[model samples]
Target: MKKRGIGIAVGTHPAGLKGGGDPSQAQIRLKPDGTFDLLNGAVDIGQGCKTILRQLAADELDVPLENITHQNIDTDTGPMCTGTFASRVTFMDGNAVLAAAADLKKKIRDWAAEYFECSPADVEVANNKVFVKGVPEKSLSMAEVGAMVNWGGKFLVGTGAYTPGPGQQFDPETGKMTAIASLAFGCCVAEVEVDTETGVVDVLKLVQVFEVGKAMNRLLCKGQNNGGAMMGIGFGLTENVCPYYPTMDFAVQDLTDYVITTAADMPPVMVEDIVEVPHPNGPRGAKGYSEMTASLAGPAILNAIHNAIGVWITDYPATPERILKALEAAHA
Candidate 1:
């Protein structure tokens, strides 16, 4: 007999430490060609932080997207940033970039006004041009302003550093702690099919809903959701880093031994809903949601199996043998 099952789980893991003081820093530089550079310490592990940070820089500075070069190479030059983890890059690192952009924008506007012999308020930068308000005919190319600043023996550079708060040391005796700067939440539902005879389980559908503050990039959010769902499936079904028990030997040695779910293993149906609720301190009210749906997938899959087979399997991977044994014991 074939059976259908459904499982659900929630994730409330935070974006960073509660009241921790770890800071993320960024530096902004204006070049003579009206282009810009963003130097930060946050390493983008292909999670799109580079693109997201660059977007923040460009938007805040009122510069063209193509005018900014993202730089995060070495500690020797890159601004200091707390290592990327806990899904804090978007919220923490982003704030730093926002501040840097604001600072650089002010300096650029100042020079733009000087070149026009008007009050800074009279000039605005948009679409890569610094123009006088209500007079389209009078405009200065951003590159011209930069060239003037350079010839005047000045460079535009701004730095921003964000630290949530001074970390409070937890009371050793009471375990009391302060609140975190921000928190991200998500919910996931998994639908699965189980085979009674062979004890094989297949994930058919996965629906995820998340509170991301804002979608800095909609496509990036979707990619993160899908990627997290598949990884969650693997975590619940396969890809165990340490399979052996107390001996601590590597049961699955490497790629050949480890079995991670691939595209073929993805669920047939996947739905993602992104909720935008602006954060008070986050850059443009955006927060991190990269790993929010990941941890929930495994539990939801496990619960779905229980809903179908009516057998509670505690051990992970829930291989065919274990399922059979659990069925036998339940019937016994």
Candidate 2:
């Protein structure tokens, strides 16, 4: 009743962002209760930017992760940033946070030295405490230092700005384009069962491999990869915009008219592999690769169909009708 076929595909999505050299900004300020108020203009639209940025901020400040409060972006209150983009948040925005963290660290230590009545070189911060070198007992909690600075001393605030750099302008003569940032690689293998009579495809297994540079947050990484696969499945199977397109007269404008892949439609067997070949220009040796996570699945599924039925369904929604027609045409 079902014929099986296998297909493999490898692809890449350019790192950095869609457009390079965009500027971003981040600000960090200490709170009254020994916590931090981190402000970055990057918006999180279900991509886990808040969690990832919080981790970055916490690492840089030597503070407990729970002590940092990430605030949403406000143009009037927060620093300027390039905003979120297709592939730029993890690399570009993260770099800005790194810059801010570095500035904040330097400021904290400088002030800590002044308060400790020692040279800046003699002060070290660890476990949310600033102490003189070799004297762990002679220390002040981060909040105490913050209160001192905020009440009458210099405000404990730091800001950072980041831009990729002087990029080449587009040239009209010879039409040559300069190289953008490096790319992340995605590899996928799709195993499918094709029912010749009904012209339906049942995806049995999907194996994915990604070169992620580094996994920032493992949970978020899983979310992106798994969610991406579902999106790819819909793209390859039964998702379409205009129901019966060409004419457009019968366009049903409702969610009910659209066929999206669901949990029940997920492949029975899914395998994932992550490769960590850190990129040189990335933050914490990490590049954003979620943009390409689901990219190769569509092509892999199409290749699988060709292998299975010896026919090509060259339409958007590879529906059962299209598959049947392709099979009939191949026979003719």
Candidate 3:
């Protein structure tokens, strides 16, 4: 007989380093052709950091998206980042890029003021053009300005760096300090069907809700949610490094022997929703959201399994053999 059950779990993840003082830096330079090069150390490990960062730069610089080229160069050429972990890229590195763009914008405005013989406050920059306020005719394209700046023996560059909070401070008595710059919270509900006779547990559906501060790119956020859901399912039911417990002997050696969840194992229905609650210190009000996307999936599925079979399978991967053994132990 197959029994069905549903369960929900909530999880939270922090952005930036635990003890604070995490820093990220960025640099931006304008090309003669009016395009921009944004250099940062935040690598895109398939999380679409390049796309979102470009979007941020374009928004800040008041230029078209294609006008920016985001480059993740080596330490020799790019700014320093405290590696990409703890879901810090979107929050920490993004702020660095925004700051760089702002710095670059100020330089452009100052140069335009000099060229137009106007005050920097009187120069207006928008849509890749610089003009004096209330005088649209007295304008020049960004490309033209870039060319003039280069010919004048000057290179336009902007550099910025960001560190969360006012450095790492500790309380003298309690030893507590501000850990994370920001936080992302999420909830996941999972439905599962368990067969008592054969000990097969099948996930039917997964629904997730996340508070991401802001969605930099909605499509990319959806993709992350889907990918995280799949990974969570794998953690709940299929992936195992040590098949033989209590000892490290005869462990699965490679990918060939390892059991994992594939596309065929995904639930039939999956839904992800985003709730935007802007952070005061985030870049464009966006938070670090990558890691929390997958945090609640395993626990939700485990709770569902207990509901279906009335047995708590405390072990990871929740293999059929383990489920069977748990059921036997419960009924005995």
Candidate 4:
């Protein structure tokens, strides 16, 4: 006999390092060809940090996205970044990029003002052109400005760094600090089928929703959501490192002994829903949401298994042996 059940779980995630002091730095330089080089240390571990930062830079500098080239992180030459984790890259590093772009824009305006013998306040930089405000007749392309600036033995550069304010305040009694800069919320619903005879559980479908502050790129956000859902299912059903623990006699050591969820094991992602509630302090109101999804699916799947078999799985992976033992104990 087989039974089906549904389970749901909700969760929240914090962006940036806990207890504060997390910092990121960035630099921007105008090339002679009118392109801008954005240098930062936010590594892209498949989370699309590079694309997001470039987007932020393009917008902040008031230039076409194609005019911005995001330089890859280089330890020796690049700016400082406190590594990428805790969903902090988009928010923390993004701020640094914005700062650098703002500085660069100001420098360009000042230089353009000097060349036109006008006040810096009267110069406006937009769409790859610098022009005197309300005096459209006097304007110069950014490419021309860059060429002239470089040829005049001068450099046009901007630099910026960001830290989440000062150190967070901690509770004296509990030793807990106010650590989070932004919060992302998520909820997941899982449907599963359980086989009574073999103690096998199969996930049929998943519906996930998340409040990600802002979707800088909707397709990228959706990809992160779906990928995280798959990871959650794997943690609940298939991936395990220590098959035999506490005794430590026969631990699964290699790939052949270990089990993981594959494409064949993936369930349909029925709904990929995202809520865009802008954050006041985020980079264009964007927050970190990738890590939150990885956690939601496991508990939801466990709950669904309990609903199907009337037994709770206290451990991860919920291997067949454990499920059968739970069932037998319940029956007994």
lDDT of 2: 0.81
lDDT of 4 at 293: 78
Q: Which whole-number lDDT from 0 to 100 does residue 142 have in model 1?
A: 79
For all candidates in order, the CA lDDT equals 0.84, 0.81, 0.88, 0.88
Winner by TM-score between candidate 4 and candidate 1:
4
- Give candidate 4's whole-model lDDT: 0.88
lDDT of 4 by residue, 58-84 (tens): 998888888888887585689999888
Residue runs of model 2 more than 4 Å from their true location after superposition? 73-76, 170-178
Off by over 4 Å in 1: 134-138, 171-174
Model 2: per-residue Cα lDDT over 48-122, one tens digit each:
988888888888778888988888668567777667765677777677888888888888888877777788889
Ranking by TM-score: 3, 4, 2, 1
Per-residue lDDT of model 1, residues 1-332, tens digit only = 78899999888766666667878899999888878889999998878889999999989877778889999988567899877888888988999999998888777778777877789888887877888898888787879877877777999898888878877888889988776677778999999998888888889999988898888999999888888888889888776666665566656778866778888998899898888898887889987668776888988888999999999878777666677889889989
Q: Distance from true position, residue 238, model 2, in Å?
A: 1.0
Native-to-model Cα distance after best TM-score fit, residue 127 in candidate 1, in Å: 2.6
Candidate 3 residue-wise lDDT, 15-115, digit = tens:
88887778999999988888899999998999998998889889988889999998896856679998888899889889998999999889999999998
